[model samples]
Target: MSLRRLLAPLCAGTLLLTTACSEGGEVAPAPRADPPAASDPGEGAAEILADMSLEEKVGQLFVPTLTGTTPEESAEVISAYHPGGFIYFPDNLQDTEQIVALSNGLQDRAVDDSGVPMFLGIDQEQGMVSRLPVGERFPDAMAVGATRDPDAATSLASVTAAELSALGINLDYAPVADVNINADNPVIGIRSFGSDPALVSELMTAEADAFEAGGVVPVAKHFPGHGDTDVDSHTGLPVIDKTRAEWEEVDLPPFVAAVESDIDMIMIAHVFMPELDDSGEPATLSPGIVTGILREELGYDGVVSTDALNMEGVRQTHDDGEIAVMAVLAGADQLLMPPDLATAHAAVVSAVEEGRITEERLDESVLRVLRLKLRRGLFDAAPVDPGEAAEVVGSAEHKDAAQQVADSSVTLLRNEGGVLPLREGASVRVVGSGSEEIGAELEGMGFTLAASAADADVAVVGTNGARGDAEQKGLVTQAQDAGVPVVVVAQGNPYDISELPGLDGYLATYSSVDVSRAAAARVIAGEVNPSGRLPVDIPGTDLAFGDGLTY
Candidate 1:
């Protein structure tokens, strides 16, 4: 079947004005309508948009950060700026009760001031990138990819969405769509699904669908792909040297699949692609990339949000206010995490008034955001119950589901001489960083702790980002030199295996979360059969994608 046929039904209720799919499996552009007057209450988002003042409309374009965990801490900004939403960070989240109170308090103030509920957004990607203080920690994207089960992706995201929604968080910046082809990528290593475009597309679409179905708006992120860069965008801007065709082959499939799946929002990356736009501007502020390619070519009319404006990647040449104006002119609907909310808000209002940004252009974005809020039932949402939230955030059922994903994703890369499935009562020495938790789990499974490599029958050494860690390599070598059978468990990036040449056994957990660690211990104890496959190829080695062994 063709891709269009498979995706047509998914685009039925898309909020874009021009990109909704027709009944005949073809995209039929809807005619743009003039802004409606605030005459009818039944007009939904249109009427709401018309009633908003210019300051209010500009305010709607930004999703800024709050000062503290309490709503009172942000009351000054809320009253003065009338922001459309607030994005939560680790400092802003405490416990379930505190989170519920904070979310409800913020929403109440927003509605009282602007007659619109705020979009409570968070970067709750689970696994390594989680922000919630209370919730089940599921495996990261690479681990989910290892299982080759799209259902696992859906279950993980669904559980995450339920927890976030219970705490009144409506927008989840998650289900990273980048296809990680570059093994040296620092920022997006395990966040990406895998190296294959088709695998990333399938898993990303499943996760996005599950998030929406579970009542949280999922923003498929770092678009045009952040998977091929070696530098972290938070520290500096990374340039992608790929031609447009090369980009289409590797970095474009998952995003294309996301748009077709009716993803409501996409976060633009901060990387600069000279081939896409040779203007020396990052994708966040590039009109050609954001407007020409993403909007015109890809036919994505949903909201386009900028990756946090406070990052150094987008702050190199422009001030916070100027960056805000440029992003709006570049066709972005939301400015996420601006460094100065007051400055960014005022600059946008000034631009619209000065004709640098037309009021119609501003309306287009405000209307899109409003339509999304209405479609997601944000305006009609009631305050989340603190008691219910406490019960639901970290429930036993959700944790079990997380453990299942971790169990299914523990990839056994090598089992030389069938060294795995260690015998019960074997004395093992566990060494290396993040191995303490693993050791505790191993001891619970009837394994005796050894004081040193020479005292142990086997050595299980943990390696995290081990490519450059000489200490980790020394630990493994120390064990091997003592003639102790070594089983190396990669707790972070699986590429660590390439650094250690000779090993009796190797296991890749692809994450260091508690659940994944426990799952690794279970695999070592022969309690669970290892079923995960390699999500990415290990450079300088014969270990390629889909490589794993079972006893």
Candidate 2:
């Protein structure tokens, strides 16, 4: 069927596109019957693309970071670059009222300048990598993984979507699909769902679906797996030495699940896998991985976004210009957080003009981006209401949901002779990184607070990654030597338990958020049962995945 014929039904009921209809509504007396045809999804996007200039088309491929909290602060960049989207950082946000104004102002500017609305994005992952400060802080991804419930993942994404949408933010760079198999992984430690590929796949897909259902675009991140690496990609490059089979077994399953579930976007990682591409290029700049593996082998034709271009992992061998051009050549539809926006934008424009990057290639990405925007109703979305935003974000119901996840995720790794569920009204002394918060929670639960371990019946010591911190480990020793029952709580990383051995009781909260801390206090006080299991194996110990104790 012709494109015009297919689009007629879509325009039949709308007065906005009068051009799509005949000069008049005059109909033939005897019209021949035709078979019903399925509408072409790309027709509307293609029509929009046909009218765009080369610069505007190229601009649609870049989602850069804003300079400040308000739209006026970023006016120069917005007017010059015409970015398709803006990623929010901590500095770019203040409170709900300001955020709504910023989002609405930016969108108005984009619409006025180029007749296109911008994609307002944020990394509101709600755990360690959260960007928004006003929402109900939920536990980390690994904490949810410990609960072994996919519903928790869905709730997290759903609540996040609602809160973000209220604040006029539409895209969420979240639901990290990396199956964290390496215990030494610095960046993706607690951000990932779990170590098991199947578990990660299940939870990640659930979150992605929930985000989409709640009218927010979800971007599955660090593709080709940022897990299984010892280096932090933000400051340095991480090289993962794994055979293709090993990569498929460990890193590929979650991405495969994401692809199969039709995720809206996938953020490419900056890790170097020599086995995938021998050219020493990171996944963000390698056609062999981005185009060959993700597009060809995996059949993901949706929007493929590169990780932050400012990161050292992708910047070691190329300048901002080269990195931007190479990412397009490598099949990334979106260039996120480019180090230098002007240089990157000019480079992509020059590449297309010089035949280094074809206009056809550029259109493929622009079309994908436009299709997503159109599909998500970005073209017709109304300005967000600031009053509504205030009522929706960080609501009481949302806080309850967060607390439930935290409560279910408090994994009791060890409770020797039931040292936990301390005797009613037992005097406790809290110490360590989060001791102040933990102590406050215990006091609220009617436990008597003691100044020192020597004066307490139990020493509730909190450790946040005590593996390298001697002071934190010493607190545990002091509690043990004082002849008080030491109940160590691993508030950050679960591996802290291995460092502080011989504890009378041990708990792994997997995060240090207020909700997680409050849940830990409840677990100790026997108000809530410990049901969370190990999401990752404790290195250098017999403790494996799926290990946890209950009251």
Candidate lDDT values, in order:
0.88, 0.87
Q: Using lDDT as the measure, which candidate wins?
A: 1
**lDDT string, candidate 1, 96-156, tens digits:** 9999999999987776566667899999887789988889999789999999999999999
State residue 234's C-alpha deviation in candidate 2, in Å. 0.9
Clashing pairs in 2: none
* RMSD (CA, Å), each prediction: 9.3, 5.6
Q: TM-score for all predictions?
A: 0.92, 0.93
Clash-forming residue pairs, model 1: none
Prediction 2 TM-score vs. true: 0.93
TM-score of 1: 0.92
